[model samples]
Structure formats: structure tokens, C-alpha cells
Target: MATITSAAPAATSDDRFFMRMAIVIAFTIVAGFALNFAMGRSTIAARPLVHVHGLVFMGWVILFLTQVRLATGGSLAQHRRLGRIAAGWVCVLVVMGLAITVDVTMRGGTPFFFLPQHFLIANPMTMLCFVALTTAAIRMRRRSDWHKRLNLCATISIIGPGVGRLLPLPLMVPYSFDIVIFVSLLFPAAGMIHDWRQSGQVHRAWVWGALAIFLIVPTSQIIARSPVGDMIYAAVTQGHPGEKVPGLEFPPSPMPE
Candidate 1:
């Protein structure tokens, strides 16, 4: 009885910590996009596809916050039921994310700081990583600690878009994508540190999940600079406006504001 009583407080504390982390991540995403809109970098006037993409992406953030609240509020059955809806939602996110990347690239809308080829390849790779981590978290749902950490990491995976918007990416040039990816890791890194302080060791899920997210940096560079990547890029941009823009080189920066 004493052991149960002692452990309950710790579990409650952990739940609060994770709930806080989820809010921070969701805010980072919302703030990033909001920053872009404030600077005239994004708009509702974008194409229909872009509007759909934004709505779907925002939907995931909302659903994640809902799940975190549901779980923390001790509504596990509600959490699990909503988790099923989230599963389908992520699939839509992946598809919309990739489709928009392709659409933007073909239209020569790839950000000036990013090589079109790298942008094309990296977005899909990141989406795949998100799916992989999320799937693992769902599978480990019975293991609450593993489930929460993995899901948190998975959500972190998609924040690159948000983080990039917040950074002076044009100034970063060749390293912009990698830098955004690295900064995004801080969220999971914080979780690892918190776990170590509270439990005397970091969880294995954080190590593996962070590794998966971090690898996108070098893996994206290697593939984007490779012959196979060139072929894929050429095939994608052939006869399109993107063809006029070099896949391996950054586009000319917009004039100073």
C-alpha cells in the first residue's frame, strides 16, 4: 500500500510533464506559421492544395493536444478511441505533406534557402520518420511511458516546417535544413534529460527515437547530393518551372525587406 501510494505521485508528475511538452511543441508549430503570416511569408490566398495542407497539418496539432489532455485527464478510453482517428489523420498528413512539397517544387515555389531536390527528398523522409515513430508508439500503447515518449518524439518530427519558418533560413543558406532539424531535437533532448533526472536514467525510447529523427540530417544530404537523387530530381522537375531552377543549388534570395 505504501509503495502504491508513493508511485502514484511520480506517475502523476510524469503525466503533467508530458502534457506540458505537448503544449510547447504545438505552440512552436502554431507560432512558426503565425510568424510567417505576420511577415507576409504565407497566406490563406495560397492555392487550394496549400489551404488543405494547412488545415490538415493544424488538425494534427489540435488532435495531439487533445490526446495529451485526454490522457492526462485520466480519460484513457477516450484517448484510445481518439488515437484511432489520429492514426488515419497522420496518413492524411503524410499524403498532403508530400503532395504539397511536389506541388510547390514543380511550381518553383521551393524556398530560396533550400535546394529543390533536397527539399523534395527531405520532406518525404521526415514524414516517413514521423510515421515510423508514431506507429511504434501506438504498438507500445500498453506501455504508457514508452508510448508517451515515442509519440512526443514523433510529433517533434513534423515541427521542422514550423521551426524553419521561425529561423532566418535564407541567411543560413546551405545548412538551413540541417540546422532546423538539429534545433528540433532540443524538445526530445529535454525529455531525455528530464527522464534522467527523475528516474536516474534516460529511457531507451528517447535514444532510438532521437536517433531516427537526427539521422535525417546526414541521410538527406547524402541522398540529395547523390546521382540517384539527381535522377529523381530531374524526373520530378522535367519540363516544369522547377527545371529552370537548379536542383543542387539554392535559388537566388529575395530582395532585402
Candidate 2:
């Protein structure tokens, strides 16, 4: 009876914490994109592929919020069913993410603040991080503590694009990628703090997840500046407008109207 009583509250507290975190993340993504659209940074005139990518990403956010609700609401049976679907969704998400990265870079549409090489490398690396963490979450689903925390981290990993949109990337210039990464880490950092406060120790899953995000930024930059990065960028942009755009150099700021 004592164990049951104590465990009940801890579990309830965790559910509430995760639920809140999910809502915040969802809001961040939606607000970032909506703000971009409002500012004319995004457009309805974008190619069909871009539109499909947007829809796919928005679908994942909705699905993520739904999963959190089901789990916190004690609908584990339904949550697991959705979990199976989410596993497949991650694959589609990754494909679309990589596809859009290549599509934009080929069109010379890579963000002005990012080196084309860095944008190409970083986006895919971020997706890979999400895939690895999410795979771990699914495999350890029976360990609810590890499972939920890993899922949160996985979602947090990919929010850099959304976070980037919320910031003044033009003003950020050389350090925009680094600043976006630092802001994104705040989500998982909050998770770590919450875990510490609740249990007197931070969970190892949070540590690993945060570390993955931390390492990927520098690692991607290093590769983007290396010979291998040159070869990959050259191959991808062969005979295209992007080839004339220096892979390692940031594109010039557009002239104000």
C-alpha cells in the first residue's frame, strides 16, 4: 500500500510534466511557422514538394500531441497503437526532411545565413539524431520512464528549424546555426531540470539525448568545412546554380526593397 501510494503520485507528476512539455514544443513549432508565413518568409507559391513537406511535418506535430494526450489520460492501449504508427511516421518524416534539404540546396534556396554545405549536413544530421533517439524509445517502450523521456528528447532534437524561424537569423549571421542549436537545447535542458527536481537525479536518457544535440552542431560544422563536405556538396549541386554558390561560404544578404 505504501509503495503503491508513493508510486502513484510520482507517475502522475511525470505524466503532467511530459504533457506540458509536449504542449510547449507543439506551440513552438506552430508559432514559428505561422510567424514565418505572417512575415512572408513562407509562401503559398512554394513548389508542390515544399507544400507536401509542410503538411507532413505538421501532421507529425499533431500526432505527437495526440500521443501525449493518450498516454497521460491513461489510454495506454491506444497509445501503443499510435506508437506503432508513429514509428512508421518517423521514417516518412526523415525522408521528407532530407528531401527538402536537398531540394532547397539544389535550387540555391538554402537560408542566406547558413553556408550551403552546413545546411546540407546539419539538417540530415539532426534527422539522424531524432531517428536514433526515437528508435531507442520504441525499443525500450516497456520501461515507461526511459520511453517517455527519450520520445521528448527526440522531438526536441528536430525543433531547431522551427526555433531558427523564431529568431532574427539575418541579424545573427555567422552564428545563427549555433544560436538556434543553443535555443533548441533549452527544451531538453528543461527536461533534465524537471527530472532532477522530481527525483533528485537527472535521468541518463536526458544526458545522452542532450549530448547528441550538442555534438551534432560542431561535428556537422567540421564536416561542412572539410574536403569530404566539398565533394558531397559538389556532387549534389553539379551543373546547378548552387555550384556557383560557394558551399563553405555564407550567401550574401539580399538587398532590402
Candidate 3:
């Protein structure tokens, strides 16, 4: 009886915490894209491929929220079913994302706000990070310590674009993307703090996830501007967008707030 009663509270608390986190992720994604797309601020609407990419990503957001809701509601059976489906769905998402990245690089349709080279490196990296983390999360599903945090990190990984739109990326100029990436850390930071307060130490999943995000910024920044980067950019944009746009200039300038 004692064990059952104590376990009940712990289970309830876990559900509450996870449910609230899911809400945060869902709201952030939906609201960010709604503002960007509805306002015609994001250049994604201009191209058919980009439009499809948007739909696929939005589907992931909805699926993620649904899975979280199902698990928290104690519908583990339904959640596992959805998890199987998501395995296939996530593959589609990653493929669509990479395809769009290639399309943008070749066509030079990158938002005038971003340097084509930076877009080439950074965009794909985000997808790769998300894929790796999510794969680990799925594999370690039996270990809730790793499962939840890794999944959250993976989902949050790709939100940089949406976040970039929400913030005044232009106002920051050279450090624009970096600022948005940093701000996005708050979500994971909350998780880390929760883990600390609850367990007296941060979980390995949070540490790994946070380390990946922390490393991404500096690593991409360096490579995006190097000679090798220049060579890749030249090849990808041969007679393409880079030729037309200076790759680093804000000539098309961000719009007024």
C-alpha cells in the first residue's frame, strides 16, 4: 500500500511535468510558424518545395504533441502505436528537409536575409542533430531518463528557424542566428534545472543534448566561412544564388518590425 501510494504521486508528477513541456514545445512551434507564414515574413511560401517542407515539419510538431499527450494521459498503448508510425514519419521528415536544403542551395532561393553558405551548413546540421538525438531517444526508450530528454532535445533542435523568425535576427546582424540559437536553449535549460532539483544532478541526456547545441554554433560559424566552405558553396551555387547575392550582404535587408 505504501509503495503504491508513493508511486502514484511520482507518476502523477511526471505526467504533469512532461505534459507542460509538451505544451511549451507545441505552442512555440505553432505560434512561431503561424506568425511567420501568415505574415508572409518567411520566404518559405515563395517556393513549392519549401512549402512542402513546411507542411512536413508542421506534421512532426503535431505528431510530437500527440505522442506526449498520449503518454502523459497513460495511453501507453496508443503512444507506442504512434511511436512506430513516427519512426517512418521521421524518416520522411529528414529526407524532405535534406531535399529542400539541396533545392535551396542549387536554386539560390535562400532568404535574402541569410548567406547562402551559412544556410547550406547550418540548416542541414540542425536536421542531422535532430536525427541523431531522436534516434538515440528511440533506442533508449526503456530508459526514461534518456528517452524524454533526448526526444525533447531532438524536437527543439529544429526550432531554430522558427525562433530565428520570432526574434529580431536582423537587428543582431553578424550574431543574428547565434542569438536565436542561444534563446532556444531556455527550453532545455528548464529541463536541466528540473532534473537537478529532482535528482540532485543533471541527467546524462541533458548534458549530451546541451553539449551538442553548444558545439553547433561555433563549429558551423567556423566552417561556413573557411576556404573549404567557400569551395563547397561555389560548387553548390554554381551559376546559382551565390553568384547573384554576395552570400554575406544584407542587400535585401530585413523588414521593419
Candidate 4:
């Protein structure tokens, strides 16, 4: 009698895809924490609200890492179980994010190394975009492809803070406003690269989203300096104790032409 042979079960493609995603997520988390540490040290004397924002943002990073780990480790049921908690956590994150933006602007705490006039507008717009993308991602959670893409977009949206911190602020001061566009574009670039490597095609939505974010920086600056934005800023700051208006200055008594 001939001996019977047993074949090993082959791993599914989903397993390989999940493994790759896990690696990328892990790398991003490590990079984020390192950047945070470096920037936090430089801004050690920053206001309490800055620290609060950092803590909340770091909590989000931790949660993201945990979720990725859980999903990749064959804990889908437990991951779904924690989805509700994550949703509530995201709400708190949005609240803290908005509160930090308001407090920073009101207290004249926008990073001084950059052009405050543009930074003020860009920062808040970033927060708003982050919230919008994140909410949309959550809404499409049941649709795996849509959910994944939206979640990646949301991740890119929030990355400005991390990227801004990691960049050499002093070196970029001359083109501070433009740096926002550069940083925002990086996320979509990363996504495009990932998609190209994984599926041999770049997703159209991500391409569009990246382009939108790149445009938003300049557009937001234009709007912020416009009459309407000026009026809104003035109204919002009217009741605040120590608000400051940001603008460029010209020296008095110019040399004769």
C-alpha cells in the first residue's frame, strides 16, 4: 500500500494584506511618538492646553495601534467590541481638538516661529478637516473598502500636527504657510505609494483628497485674510482677555526713493 500524503493549508491573501498594513501602522506609530517627544521637548513651556492636546492626540495614536494589532492578531470579534469605545473616544478627541485650537488662538499661543497670520488659519482648518474625514470614515465603517480608504484619509488629515512638529521649524519659517501644503500632501503621497505597491493602482479618491488638502492651505490663508474672516476673527476675539491680531509690519520713516 502506498503511503498517503497530507498537504499544508495555504495562507489567504487577506492574511498577507493585514500583515503589511500592520507593519505600516506600527511604523507610523513609532515615528509619531518620536516626533512628539522631540517637539514636546522644544515646547516644554507651552500652555496647559497644548499639553492636553498632546495627551489626547497621543491617546488616539495608541488606540489606532491597538486596533491594528487586535485586527491582525485574529481578534476581529474583540476588535469590533472595542469599536464602540473607540467611537466615544473619538468624540472626546474632537472636543479636545477644537478646544485646543480655540484656546491657542485666543491665548496668542500659535507657534511664534511661523507666520502667525497664516498659522492661525491653517491650524484650525486642519482640525476641522481631521474631524470631517474621521466622521466620514466612521460612517462608512461597514463597507470595508470605503472604510479603509476613508480611515487612511482621516489619518492623513490628522498628520499635520506630527509632520509640523518633526519638520525643522526654524528652517521653514521663510515659507511657513507653504509648509502646511507640503505636509498635508505627504499623506496622500504615502497612500498612493501604498496603493501602487499593494494593488498596482492609485485610488482616485485619495488622489483627489490629497489635492484638496494641498489647495486648502492657500485657500484658507486667502479666506482668513479676507474681510469676512477678519470680521469673524474680530468678533470672536472681542470678548477674550488677551487675544492678539497677527499681521506683517513695515518700519516707519522709509529711506527717500
Best lDDT among the predictions, by candidate number: 1
When 1 and 4 are scored with lDDT, the better candidate is 1
- Which pairs clash in the backbone of model 2? none
Clashes of each: 0, 0, 0, 0
lDDT ranking of the models: 1, 2, 3, 4
Error of 4 at 46 (Å): 5.0
Q: Which residues of candidate 3, in runs, are more than 4 Å off? A: 1-4, 42-45, 248-251, 254-257
Clashing pairs in 4: none
lDDT comparing candidate 3 with the true structure: 0.80
User: Cα miss at 240, model 2 (Å)?
Assistant: 1.3
TM-score leaderboard ranking: 1, 2, 3, 4
Global CA lDDT of candidate 1, please? 0.92
Top-scoring candidate (TM-score): 1
Question: How far does residue 188 in candidate 4 sit from its true spot (Å)?
Answer: 2.7
Worst 10 residues of 3 by lDDT: 245-254
Residue lDDT tens for model 3, 1-257 = 99899779767776788789878877887888788877776775367877888889989988998988887786888989999998888999999988887787787667655677788788777788888899999999998768878988888888887777677676787677777778878888988888776667887888888777767788777888888778877877777655665555554754655
Superposed by TM-score, candidate 3 places the C-alpha of residue 157 at a distance from the truth, in angstroms, of 0.4
TM-scores of all candidate predictions against the true structure: 0.97, 0.97, 0.90, 0.75
Residue 1 displacement (Å), model 1:
2.5
Please write out the lDDT profile of model 1 over residues 14-64, one tens digit for every residue: 988999999999999999999999989787888899999999999999999
Worst 10 residues of 4 by lDDT: 1-10
What are the lDDT figures for the candidates, one per model?
0.92, 0.90, 0.80, 0.62
